[model samples]
Target: MSRRRVKPSLYISVDIEADGPIPGPYSMISLGAAVAGRQDAGGFTPADPEEHTFYRELRPISAEFDEQALAVSGLDRDRLCREGADPAAALSEFTAWVGEVSTGAQPVVCGYPVAFDWMFLYWYLIRFTGGSPFGHSGCMDMKTLYAAKAGLPLRAVAKGTMPRHLLSRRPHTHHALDDAVEQAELFANLMAWEGPGA
Candidate 1:
């Protein structure tokens, strides 16, 4: 009997809901990711993890949390303190989890507006781990890709133009996991439509 070999083309889609924009100055309240790859000949890749692989809230490092961001994400500071993990510990666990999921494959970490999420995560990972396993460069920003491919202005690619099913039914929620899933869904749809060559 021949053993079947797994061919993994893994990619990690990540999102971070932060207290504000500036990385070190602001705080990241929550983080989420959806790992995707084709299995065997045919199987559905999930946007949300079957077993909740990557999702975490972190205790705020700064004294101030952005009111607007908090309103959008609805993550109470008290709740974060009570439920979230320490920053360093969370990064370690997340990185370890990424290693497990990718299994030696350096999965692409993607985001809707990857600049914001990538900046915060890259800073956090470097601060905690001295460096990130995912290289410093090479992030896939869906917004930029869409703009370039669709020949649409960046402003036109707002939340409204993005597919509705991808986003939460509720109003604009800044929760990291929710946004990450939404972005991943959008990316999947785009790839399906354009057939990777695009």
Candidate 2:
């Protein structure tokens, strides 16, 4: 006489800044995440992304870094070297925060192009925290979601191609937290959209 429980999906918008192409050689210099919303049988319920967010600038794991990659974030690695958070503690805190925000729901991370962000995050989570709050497959790509919903080819779909209404008003600052919040708004908008011709 017992019924099954269905956990809702808590969509988290995450963005990271790294110093090189991959995780092992490079390090995740910064990480930012915002609770975009939750989804269940009743559909999506958007959150105030600003209300629940996390950001951390981490110390470099290695001495090697690509200058071009470092320039994009404009973060002072020298300063980070002296003052940034330890990778293990930072990721542990991140895991705790994700757990707190995702209580009663499943934490599912989403990013503009999720592959890159997920790559760095998953690697760091396992390397530093020993695991991920999102498990192995709890992820969604905003670009791919938009492509599927809007019926456009994935390669041709970019922020510029999307209808203005679907885009967030927030500027795409290179700052991790800023971009995470911006993407949260975009995620909410996309979730509610019925797509073109609907």
Candidate 3:
């Protein structure tokens, strides 16, 4: 009997900036993704995040906006409305990039707090590109991962609480791609870490 080969998982660190709280009501103004690494039986192999990345600023789909949310990203709604990439085209290009980068592996989207990012990314990908390259379950939450590894309550875990060694040196700039690349480094570091005891 032949043993089936296990495909490695290509961890893509993703981040998104939106105009409001939810997908249909709000708009995802910007999106970013970086290939964190690939993991097989041997373990994770870190990637050069800058070498494989994707980013797009999208036109708002709705007129509604949240002043506080927009302030965090520092993206001009008026400017995006006039010059941003079309959602369909941007998402299609992103899907293609995901496929190209994970040709022989399964693609997984990872984020500092994956829920928010996944919500927008999945919604946009399905709404614009008809489906998602990562599927429904291919997501990893770095925050939750840290919680489990550190034996701490999920709600108690925060970047400030984590050891400096486990945290990436990259600054958490709000620019989608900058944050994505920064979190990619964090994800790689988390994967290689053996918890507080180690």
Question: Which prediction has the highest lDDT against the true structure?
Answer: 2
Model 3 segments more than 4 A misplaced: none
In candidate 3, what are the lDDT values of residues 1-198, reduced to their tens digit?
A: 998999999999999999999999999999999999999989999999999999999999999999999999999999999999999999999999999999999999999999999999999999998899899889999999999999999999899999998887988989999999999999999999999999
lDDT of 3: 0.96
lDDT of 3 at 127: 93
The TM-score measured for candidate 2 stands at 0.97
lDDT winner, 1 or 2: 2
Whole-model lDDT, model 2: 0.97
lDDT of 2 by residue, 1-198 (tens): 997989999999999999999999999999999999999999999999999999999999999999999998999999999999999999999999999999999999999999989999999999998899999889999999999998989999999999999999999988999999999999999999999987
lDDT of each: 0.72, 0.97, 0.96
Ranking by TM-score: 3, 2, 1
Report the Cα lDDT for residue 9, model 1: 46
Candidate 2 residue pairs in clash (backbone atoms < 3 Å): none
In terms of lDDT, the poorest run of 10 residues in model 2 is 128-137
TM-score of 3: 0.98
Candidate 1 per-residue lDDT over residues 1-198, each given as its tens digit:
997865544556788888886777788888998764432346435454334458899998878767887676788888887777899999999988887877745566777788888999999999877778677984778787767666778878876775554444433346677666666666665544442244
For residue 106, model 2's alpha carbon misses the true position, in angstroms, by 0.3
RMSD of each: 5.2, 1.3, 0.9
lDDT of 1 at 177: 70
**What value does the lDDT take at residue 149 in candidate 3?**
96
For candidate 2, give the lDDT of residue 97. Answer: 98
